[model samples]
Target: MDEESRNGGPDSRQFDVSGAKINILSDEYDPTVSLISSNEKWVEDDEVPRKEVGTSSFWQATSNTVALLLGTGMLALPYAVMLGGWSSLALLAFFAIMFCYTGCLLGSCMKENPLLTTYQEIAGSALGLRGRILFTIFFYVEVLANRVGFLISVGDNLARIFPGVESHIPAWIHLSPSMTLASLAMLLISPTALIRDLSNIAYLSFGGIVTSLVVVGAVAWTGTTVVGFNQPIPFANFGKWRFILGLYSYCYAGHPVVPNIHSSMREPSKFPVMLMLSFTIATTTYAGIGLMGASMFGKETLSQITLNIPRDLMAATIVLWTTVLTPLTKFPLAVAPIATELESFLPFDSHSTAHYVFGNIIRLGILGLILAVTITFPYFGSTLNFIGSSITIITCIILPCVFDLVLHWRTIPKLQLMVDIVFLTAATCFAIVGTFSSGGV
Candidate 1:
């Protein structure tokens, strides 16, 4: 293939992934997110360099990486265990390990195709043109749906926090003014539009984690007494099918983010470290939060979390942070799909006013749609399951390994092949069951 044909994006822009330095990966939560922000141009800051952010420190990346998948998913994890039983958590741990291995595969993939810009590109490399078309088309659509779900949840959560605001309007305003405003506001801050790369988003990501930890701590203290730390952690039953499926689904949620994150760095040498660190922290956080929720509330756990604990001051703080920062989660999700779509036509568009304006309009629509869906579901489990499960299956489990193997199958190390088999098998089964269980969600 000619260099230009191979490199031209749908928009006809050069693929531009020249270095091991990271390209952008859009957010995992895509459906209802704003895409405009994903196009923001980055200007390298010599004064504040990569070394400042751990200089590719695995531990540092690990800390942020764990927090990456730690949001809304953790809040519901404990309850999933309760619904499915302790066996669910045990099963989930295996999925976590599997995802981490996927993370390693992704890291290795980056080492080879440091310029791989999107999941579709990686998939194309693996299985050829058909794979790229299939991967990109469905992936973007699913991301679009997820952005909608996330916006709705944000509205529902806001209403829960501010009864006054809810009273000022309808009790169920998933598509309410508040959601409209927040989504619009986020559209304005398109991370994609920002000059910094994916790592730059890490700045906000770290801050979000601090707030989440505080909330986790608050929930932990108020609820569970940890009556049995040594209570023979139950042996997992992968045979239960449904429970195993759910856990695997949760762990694989972070896989779609690999290509861009891996490629967008000074040195891809430490990509595996980032993935391992991220998953390890993520698993521990999920377990702790899940254990606390179950031990404390057991069957009584509230949907979308019953954080109605009576800490007026702390509640206000967390509510503010979650509401404000939470909106940002969908920014990358919004950006990725639009970027893909934009590439499909009129590929020469750059950072003109027309680009941002058009980008913002799409962003507003996507976010508005998310708010609308939440109005209907109102429950976190439903949306989380809906967007979370679909994306998790396509991007996280099946695609990553398939793509990696496609590109490197001729000489893939035996060890990597085994990891690929385990994750792909686990992901495929979970996707099949998730389709059935969440068919109507």
Candidate 2:
């Protein structure tokens, strides 16, 4: 498809492509009506005078990317190693490298079409409306799943920090300690989700990075000085390879938000560098904590490494608190794109009073749904595994390569084409195996 066809027609008004408004027509026409009516038209006109709304600097973008990649999933890496064996570290490394490459592929896809501001838009541009819908379902579900996982993690770590808190609950309240803590966390996080600009939350993202480092340091200290790494780590265990692959896939589940981060960058061209730095830092942290926690606890490791830390130790308290903080900072970032997309479907202009009120309502509604899910099926590891296997593989690995190939098939080099096909096939296989394994099918 040509640029006009891919983006929509020349006169259509698109939504959420950019924050700034472009008033091509005079004061006679109602932009809101046109926006609501032609929201499906995704094209940007070259002739229209438009302004870019991106304001994030290189470091801020890098920080957001890092925070997005290294979420509650990091806590599960050691447990993942426990399942797949020590040799699974190689699989972790492979995913880290491949996801970084695929993330760059997303950037490339965005570069080819500047109007493509969301992951769904990238799919829509490549494979049309059906592709966009397919990706939208997977991407939104993945974001919601991540939010649920975050609340579950917050609850898990908080219970670790304050043991026996569950006993204090009144008989009438009918809530577990983890559920209560997660409810409180949801209340605190709901406000941040209302912020429209990614740049505004960059500091929170930086805070997440700091808290992650502290968690990693705490794990290292516990392993080296407290627990001692004497447990034997096997070379390989093919039995749980499916689940292991899903866990590794979960670590790099940041691609859905990549376009938003790229669009928010002051220097979008440096996105590849941002991806490199973000992935490098995240991979190192994952590897360090996974190796240390697995070698220290082995078969005894809990789903969350924070849970494995000795509760009696002061360091465990500090680490648990930091782990609690990590997800609070990340929940907003993960849900931002979903909120933006939901807001677009509303019958109002972007950033208007109606939009603001309804946008907050949408975000709060999303949090409510997440809270309900967290309270109901509070299985952290299973939730992450299902999300990674069933949805994340499609969003992070398969779709980027598919979009790249579809958009640049004729011009793409033969070598790159072959590589994309290989990635597509492998990711498909991994998704099938991991999904069935998670479902016990």
All candidates: TM-score? 0.70, 0.77
C-alpha RMSD (angstroms) for model 1: 7.8
Give the C-alpha miss distance for residue 402 in model 1, angstroms.
1.4
Off by over 4 Å in 2: 1-64, 111-118, 171-175, 187-203, 260-274, 329-364, 439-441
Regions of model 1 farther than 4 Å from truth:
1-55, 112-120, 164-206, 224-248, 260-270, 306-324, 328-360, 413-419, 439-441
lDDT of 1 at 84: 62
- Model 2, range 105-203, lDDT digits (tens) per residue? 988987876666667677888999898778767756776787788789999888777778888888898888888988988897788878765556544
Candidate 1 positional error at 370, Å: 2.7
